[model samples]
Target: MSTIDVVEVQPPALWEAKRTKQRTVVWQEFGLLGIFTDQKPKIKQDGICSQQLLSTTEKSGVMDSVGVPGPEEYEEQHVHEVYEQIASHFSSTRYKPWPIVESFLQSLVPGAIGLDVGCGNGKYLTVNREVFIVGSDRSTNLVKIASQHQPHAAIVADTLSLPHQAGRFDFAISIAVVHHLSTPERRKEAVQEILRCLNAEGKALLYVWALEQKTSRRGWDEGHEQDVMVPWVMKTGKKNPNEDGSMEKTFQRYYHLYRSGELEADIAAVGGKLIDSGYEKDNWWAIFQR
Candidate 1:
């Protein structure tokens, strides 16, 4: 009979001091276990010990086994969550409808069925009251806010997959929407979806954030990531009882800034003919026919 010895090794004094209440214990009989004090675990996988060390870093917010999000997921998270969080504040600021968009809306025939994709607060839906507009948004809260604006119909739907029959709408408008889509494929799909819902001779307007914007203070010549996060500051008028609430909270939103001719290219990619396309007020606007 062979006797095995069990030794309880104490972690280094440096590691012991940094250990928090949250600790992950791995039991192994024989092997050199490398525990890092910098929150990054360097584990050796060979011989008798084949298990991997699973740890999380608080400072970096990176966790093991939890997969990182792709661009699409990050876009969805920011678009959905940020809008939901700031829906009230957003509705308050979006009271005025764009005159250019209103002029386009007026061009539609009276009693025409129109689709307002990604309609936040339904500001544009109120335009051309003669045309019965059906508003749809990805954010449920914003949809609810839009419902208050008295659209003919309000539905929660994704831009990529609109909840409408083919050729059901005489016209469609996707304002400030396509840029939220993370990938080119998704942006194309959204345009295709709008075209699918419109009649064969129908026309649609699409708007996206422009790379050149005076308000953004981003230089046109400066190199920047196409996909970026913009912050929205939330105002809380009253100070907290416990502490001074002078610090305003800000929410970050995902936006895919469009370069010159990008909007037209996206429309052309979806088999739509671009009637007109240009930049206006920090956004790229395009009118297309299906």
Candidate 2:
């Protein structure tokens, strides 16, 4: 009774208010007992406390720590956006068709129905008029450009999910396109989609950037990531248009570089019979029969 005075300590107003609000939400959502029963908060590598509201595995499928988009999302956004932004520049540089591609088109039977998946600028579509070719691409801008260049029809459609009927096309070609699929699953899906659109005896051709190209005289480097965004520098002119001397703008395009046998293996995985496969001129080409 003689003389001790009791004192109470309180957290700072702002911090205490935030804590109160959090507690209120927790209680409202899970009830008061849940505050104790829930798992302890986890400190992330970045030194922030995670709510521990959902299991790590539950959220891991959609996003990583710090909320970065997963591979599929990143690939879709990057590939489509970059292609749209640089469609004109890209089309201007893609006027020539590869000789091998031309040969494959020439081999197709006359009046045979064909599909061109990811037919940028429709370079290959212009070849082999005897074969009625329909082109599809993911980029609308590229599709428009393709429509202007080729008399064949062009549609903005994804290779993984073509708008065509199954077993409709006698032949299909996906040149330098499957490599844009940033994951093995996606690459396989695209090949399978192509196969699905083909008749039982239908054949398809695929081209992918070769990993061996790094050793070629062209000096193409296989970057550290198998799936990477390669930059395309568009130079305004040799002379600097700006006083500051910046005449080039770099844009990123997605690519999945393939090793010697990777393209063959991917096609085979989808029950496609490989007719022939080889590495040529910084690319891996394969002919497959459905």
Candidate 3:
């Protein structure tokens, strides 16, 4: 069995590694289609956000097949990572405020156990007292900052390689971090892992840079520094110092420039059903149902 296997097996590839009698095994493979970003609390009825929300019940972003990371590329990934390490916990992002996070959480309805899946700086998780929340991220340094900031609600883990129980959550929120994944495989793995942790009816919310938005604002466009944005495997998993006086081992992740269709396909392939999705100005946000 693959070390990564956690679900029942019927392996057609990875997750479908078991055999069973078949009869033209069919699936609703309608070409997947599908992110959005906006912080308007108490939105106007039947407005743009409302329209996008309505469309999601039928069709969402974009959907398309994606390639896996090469096996050779896996072992080759090893390097030190320097992550941002200021204790920026409490309600707002480095760019905005706590109420924005609260307002977003409020839209999801009350009492849904939620997660800040790349909950950097522990900002929202720290001060937003109403939601049943848990915090997770790939960076140990950032996790430390989170623990120091909101010790009650944090866990250190990678979305690519999660360390959580299956169906353990009701909802997950990722903000301004999905694009950093760098590759399609990592992207799928991240989504798959997150879904694995959700209850069947659970939700996964993401705040991502909008593909339709002008590329000038994103760091991955041309003239972007490869060494800075795309991480390099330094010494093959060896511990090393980074920019912020912390230590990390670089894992293989490739940043992707998403189109709507590709995002939708990803959610469906992993047994997910998209609920609501849209893009607003600079970022894209979507919520998927497991």
Candidate 4:
């Protein structure tokens, strides 16, 4: 991605429902730190940008707070930066929501209000006008992009501490954002925030990146090292091992990969139920009824 993409992000301009002094900042990484790639994620190769957008890099100095930025802020900032970087690799105009999100929306109650948390550019808004949908993302530029794409859709704020009232949306869907969270503690909070926003009996749909059960754990970017408890290697690289292990690994962090059974336990801890869960397109999509 071009450095110009950074120039496009305005930290002060990021979306905020109401600016408050000493606002309680929720620092959930949302899995941004998990991009443990030996290779730098480039826009061109990732197919996130076209040649024209890559020519320039925008510089927006980081100006959130005085002390070291917290993990959530760090991850959030990283995502915005990556978002800009990837923009150079692909046309931001083109979009198509994944089948799971689309299919879930199809079952919505008439006049049901839906929240697309991390709604990237509001492509779903254009497709599902039948339901009242509001798309929101922490990235100010992306929100603006979404506004341009889906003018009718409401785009605003971060999910960590949402501005909306409890039970605001009939259902809330967070796709591909959970994996950005580096730690499970942060992810659970995100889940709570989402659950808090849903009405009783409301559904919260989430998609988490997971490795298949049958796949060998060795191929992961974060290799597995041997476990003292388990016979085989739990981790391979230097420090962090077992991060690349089995489904149990992801739950309690037995593996870097995520498995349905592991996630279900995590979901249960937060008083959320995984009504339906499955693997599709390398993502474990869970439909949770609160």
Candidate 5:
């Protein structure tokens, strides 16, 4: 097996070491810290970018109201920034549409206008050209790829604060998006944001990673930590020993695995009436209406 293609669990020691390593690369690469190595590092994938989008030598030092790292700050460092960096590689592996989400999109009526909250790479955008869909995500790079679907649109926007007007969309889908929120409040607010865009009778379908995915390779069970960092290992397929000789890199993305019935509880908390809900493919999905 090629060293670059190998996908194994990262050793805890090495992972911690890399996590706290000196930020030799400019702090602006991700606005906080980054690592540049002169040699290739072993890559590992715990589960599931090409440019320094923003660059500077100093830290951004962005913090929440309390002056310490809060939910937004934590997500920016672990979720948003990581997605921006690995958008290309992440998009490549996410082309296959989940069966449930596909059916949801296909079932939409023609001429219907909908929102795809956190539509990474907009794979579902191609599902139904007959219905107009506006896909939005926080990562600009992923939005760029999502915009390639004709007749559909993608924009860079946070899930917690969507730009659309209230109660305008016919439907909305937030597959694999809510799990990225680092805290319960943020996650519920994200669901509320989706519901806010729906008409009084409009519906929304949301999916989140499940904490009970014991059969999966990750083996996350009920007792496992619900809030954790999952690594996405990308093989760049190029070697540049002279500069940053990183043939591969691993990014840690934040996720809050939903336990059984947790998704329904969130919907209820957001005042959304649950229409239908189920578990599929290591994920919890719920279709609800406002």
Candidate 6:
């Protein structure tokens, strides 16, 4: 079993870890995605914030055919660690909010308290200032950048084990997040967690990569392996070019592309009532209520 230890840090950085041996698996070099920045909350690098320590088994991020690590360990390497390493670069490219997600936020009522459960760089947190949002992500680095968004908060947290109370949030969004889990059971569990955070009438939006995007650049469509490793190439500065004159290092992250009806199926499996759902820009999105 994995345990999370919440430690309060007081320093030049709020909730920042200062070299702790809490990770069951040490940080490893890997390529992953990033998120955004805007707004300035009452931040204090010298103030107090909380850090969560996730203890899970170790696994290399490399793809292999045999002896595959469990979902927790696999995600730790292929997902969380990669995001931490590429937070800045990832955030730089992720500024634009998806139209579907943007519309969802704009539709919310004023003063609505919500959660962005896998809230990378917190680009959505900027969508509706009339309402309040608490964003959470597994990457501490991303959370720090996301924390800059004002009238909102960001914290280091995992989708499967959020720090918020159940049935408390008015709404929630977990965009482009559930696809990162390596197993069907884990993906369903992720949906359950999202629904768990909602009030009786609260709605949650979720997005996942679609398997039927033949028109997209990746040209992935039906019949392609749903479970696959996608590569992210991070370009280092010109000062670090390799002999091939390429200054890029590629890292692979695992994704389980959702076919049509899959997102709704997962929501239904977890006893959530589907409010709305559709595909947009190579992803399947759904809004559901608990």
Top candidate by TM-score: 5
Measured against the true structure, the TM-scores of the candidates, in listed sequence, are 0.74, 0.73, 0.55, 0.60, 0.77, 0.76
What value of lDDT does candidate 4 attain over all alpha carbons?
Answer: 0.54
Give the TM-score comparing model 3 with the true structure, all chains together.
0.55
Quality of model 5 by C-alpha lDDT:
0.75
Give the Å shift of residue 28 in candidate 3.
44
Can you rank all candidates by TM-score, best first?
5, 6, 1, 2, 4, 3
* lDDT over C-alpha atoms for residue 57 of model 4: 22
Instruction: Provide backbone clash counts, one per model.
Output: 0, 0, 37, 35, 2, 3
State in Å the error of residue 139, model 1: 1.4
Pairs clashing within candidate 1: none
**Candidate 2, residues 1-290: lDDT per residue as tens digits?**
13211111111111221223111111111111112223543433333221313233333223223444445566666678878878888999998888888899999888899999999888898888788888989889999988864458899998887999999889999999988876678889999999999998899999889866645432334442344345555766767553556565555566777876889999899999999988778999999988
Q: What's the lDDT for all of these models?
A: 0.69, 0.69, 0.49, 0.54, 0.75, 0.75
Q: How close is candidate 2 to the true structure, as a TM-score?
A: 0.73
Choose 5 or 6, whichever is better by TM-score. 5
What is the Å distance of residue 172 in model 6 from its true position? 0.1
Candidate 6's C-alpha lDDT? 0.75
Candidate with the larger lDDT of 4 and 5: 5
Winner by TM-score between candidate 5 and candidate 4: 5
Model 2: weakest 10-residue lDDT segment is 24-33
lDDT of 5 by residue, 119-183 (tens): 99999999999999999999999999999998999999988889999999999999999998866
* Candidate 4, position 189, lDDT: 76
